[model samples]
Target: MSAIGTRAGTGAAGWVLADSWTMTRRELAHWARQPVRIVVGLAFPVMLLLMFTYLVGGGRGVDGDHAEFLVPGMLALTMAFGLEATMLAVTQDLTKGVIDRFRAMPMFSGSVLVGRSVADMLQSVAALAVMTGVGYAVGWRWHNGLTAALGAVGLLLLLRFAMLWTGIQLAMVAGRPEMVQAVQILVWPVGFLSNVFAAPESMPGRLGAVVEWNPMSATVTAVRGLFGNPGGSGGSWAAAHAELLAVAWPVALIAVFFPLAVRRFARIGG
Candidate 1:
């Protein structure tokens, strides 16, 4: 009986793992079918990189190459900006009764959300690769070597992971596909209010202070440090401890939103 029970538990765990992988493949298959989305996503950030580097020109108070500062900042912004796509996908699935169909089936609970996040993270990696390639092509170089570059990329993806769950939770709460645009509008302020495009020292005293404390700022600053880029002034505790905050901010976001997303995902049918 003991051996049978152990085997049964192992089989159940395997079933859950299989279900999660199947769901992840379903989302990946969508990417193969809709290649434009991947291209458009890659193009938008590269466009921003070009426009800002050329049109907006270099940032004030920046040290060394401006592209150095802009590239890392753009990478961080890229991570934050893509949440709308995930939210739209979630809401669309909910609204079209696809989620209902899954809920009715004998699948592993929470596998859908898991799968969505997995596919989105993979897409995030592809976006990061494209952005890094563009950065190199446009004269941005990582002076700190490969390990640091990889670490910087890891932090950016950590931000993306947090944003993924946050978007998922919001989409689940919003309940309809139409709410995508509204949630998207809210995302803009969060993205713009950060120290992505300029130095905190360059802005007004109070607004600069707020921007310094922004979560996106932490990740960008940390990445700049890892890449040996220059932009941070580093007077405030937030600026001085950017790497710490970069990890803390995203971990806190995941801590709060991951459970909320999972709970909310499970609650949709009830």
Candidate 2:
């Protein structure tokens, strides 16, 4: 190849790596400056875990260690809560013209979106660690051993990645910071309407059936199964469907939303 061609190839490769790195570093720096957000994110679920396990988890006749039952549900909810952060960041970038600046720069087109997803995954991992440590402090145990524990973690990460894409797509569609709050109101219903805090069977007839099929419900059920937690409504369709839906739904969601998020990013500031 010509010397100019060689240089061009090297530059292209460097830009790809550097763009991702720059985006990641920028996100990390932003988090470092606003550590309170991370603290609040971790604390919110921990408080819910404590309240449910002590106040309602035991009194409701849910069998099993309450902490054990609560921990897996909290893990799933923690991931659901992270969507707000993703939406906020993406919206802020859009409104602040940061994305417009990125468009003018010579960088890999895919890097910003990929980097946002990766950084959010890392944040999820940190939140998981904090929540797990708190769970242990409150007497939760994993009787199913290391493999199952790792499997549960893997499921949580998969769910986070899928949700991150959804959040990004929402931010792109909304295109303003003010819209993030309106969008976030949808999260609570989607979360509480699931089996996160109670068994589907315990819900009212029609509501129970819908909760049984919720994607978050599938994840909570599968993780609880993996963790050997009790009160999972054994022998139901959810029990049978949990494993397949837990993996497949997230994969399918990412497959649908990821490309859409990228397309939205391309059209930003246009």
> Model-by-model lDDT, in order?
0.88, 0.84
lDDT by residue (tens digit), candidate 1, 1-270: 445442344577788898899999999999899999889878999999988886676444433377887899999999998789789888887777577789987778789988999999998999899988988887899999999989999999999999999889989889888888998888888888888887889889999999999999999999999999888675999999999999999999999999988887787767
- Clashing residue pairs in candidate 2 are none
Residues 1-270, candidate 2: write the lDDT tens digits: 545542344667788887798888988887899999878877887788888877786688755577887898889988987888899888887777566778886678778887888889998999899889988988888879999989989998899988999999998888778899997899989988988877887778888888888899889988888877764674568667897889998999999999999987877667
All predictions: root-mean-square deviation over Cα?
Answer: 3.8, 3.1
Q: Against the hidden true structure, what lDDT does model 1 obtain?
A: 0.88
lDDT, residue 2, model 2: 47
TM-score of each: 0.93, 0.91
lDDT of 2: 0.84
Instruction: Report backbone clashes per prediction.
Output: 0, 0
**What is the lDDT, from 0 to 100, of the residue 195 in candidate 2?**
81
lDDT of 2 at 212: 85
